[model samples]
Target: MEWIKLIGILIILVGFIFKFDTIAVVIIAAFTTALVSGISITEFFTLLGEAFVKNRIVTIFLLTLPMIGISERFGLRQQAVILIEKMKGLTTGRFITLYALIRQLAGLFGIRLSAQPQFVRPIVNPMAQAAANARYGKISEADEEIIKAKSAANENFANFFAQNTFAASAGVLLISGTLTSLGYEVQATSIVLVALIIAGISFVLIAIDNFLFDLKMDRKYGKKSSKGGQKS
Candidate 1:
């Protein structure tokens, strides 16, 4: 009977292995776990409601999506493309590296943003594509997708590694709390210093990656068209 309480884990594993609907699989696992744990259906719903209420702030990101959608509908992406096309001597790699640096700076300042929907998809990705198009005349579909992926990767790399540079950031606070609970004294400032070092390394690595990306693109595609012979 006790072993039956672990059924939820088995269910979740099977669902993931078989590629079932993710949300449904998770919900089913929760319900099954609650039932086996002797939680009544009413009690289960109550617990779910309580958990949702406690974590409702996590859903705040959803509110930004509609605003982003409205702006995109009104040619936000097109404006970004135009802006990038107008910039002389800005190559795709240089632009992406610059954006990653900006992302890290924003994180250091505790300026949280929905990078993918708000920045990358609407601004960065299109701008990178425009920079490529400006230099190459017209890039292949595959090349455009590669640029999109690199844009997203830059956002992720900078945001994840640099957030702790803010002494009051969640990662800094968590590290401090965990160390204190383990009978060790820790300072958020110390955590931030380490985070800064990690962030610097990440910036260097991303810059190198961008340089390699530019070289690869140059090799795969021909030199910049004579009309727009700008070095990346």
Candidate 2:
């Protein structure tokens, strides 16, 4: 039975690596392992149901996907582009960097700036596309998609990594809980202060990266303009 459980975990990892649908892979793996371990199909399904009920948060988020899909289909991207274009002096990297900071600030108040259909697809993506177009004159569809993905990743890294700095953050509570469980007394404030230092360093690094990217883009645009002047 233990071997069956191990096999199920292995199958799940392999399925993830092979890019299979996660829910399908997990369900199939669970049922197969249960059968191999001499558990009846009815028992296996009951276990699955119990697990689902225990993790109802995951289920609720899954159910929200359809509403998100509907919103995205209703010209959300177009609206974001229009909103961004009206803002003066916005560059793609700068725009995303600002969003990163805002997301981190929002996290301080326990508000999650989610990526999916919430902020990324509907808001940040189109804003990024508009910025790309403003900076480069035109952007390819592939490049637009890349910008959207990069913007989302920036938000995730910034918000998640930065929020650990707050002493009362969920990360602090988690760390404190784990330490207590393991018979170690740790101060949440100390952990949070160290996390703040780490987050500060990360912010500096991201800022430098954005600055370099902007410099490169400026050089590219300058060379293109110089060549165009020669042609004229």
Candidate 3:
């Protein structure tokens, strides 16, 4: 019966596999685990409350979403498009590459951002589309989708690789603590240095990818525009 406590893991796995409501599944798993472990319902709620209180800071970031929504209602995306239009010579790929660099810098400084909602969807995607329009006149829906995907990818890659570059970042602290618990002497500073190096490498690789994408877009769109003009 003691092994029944492990049934919570099975419940969670099955729930996720079957696409159950995520919060309900997690709570059900926790309740079952507590019950099988001989913990009373009152005690379980007490533990849950304690854990929530201790980690409540994690939810603070969600507050920014409402503000972002309000801004979008006030023409935030349109303003981004207007701004991008005036920036001559800034191509879609180049703008996305620049955003990646900015995101990396923000991560290295421990500044948290909700990339997809706060920047990518509202700012980056529109600006990228505008830049493409400026250069190639108008782009296909497929190319717009490509810009959105690449913008989100840039944010993900920069944030994931560069966040640990901050000495006090969650990743650095978690790594150092785990290594120390495993009897290894690991310093957060050391992890930060390694993360910075990885960030630099990722930035270079992403830049190269953007350059290639620019070349592909040029071949597909730029030459077509020129040829159409010549025939006119």
What CA RMSD would you report for each candidate? 3.4, 4.6, 3.7
State the C-alpha lDDT per candidate. Answer: 0.91, 0.74, 0.89
TM-score of 2: 0.74
Highest lDDT among the candidates is held by which one?
Answer: 1
Cα RMSD, model 3: 3.7
lDDT of 2 by residue, 1-232 (tens): 3665567888898999999999899888888788888899999889988998998876666655787777778977777888887776677778877877777667656675456557776778788878766556665677667676777788777876777777787888999889989999999888887877777777677667666766665555432232223111
C-alpha lDDT of candidate 2 relative to the true structure = 0.74
Better of 2 and 3 by TM-score: 3
Worst 10 residues of 2 by lDDT: 223-232
Candidate 1: list runs displaced more than 4 Å. Answer: 33-38, 65-67, 180-184, 208-232
What TM-score, over all chains together, does every model reach? Answer: 0.79, 0.74, 0.78
User: TM-score of model 3 relative to the true fold?
Assistant: 0.78
Which rank order by TM-score, best down to worst? 1, 3, 2
Clashing pairs in 2: none
Candidate 3, pairs of clashing residues: none
Q: How many clashing residue pairs are found in candidate 1?
A: 0
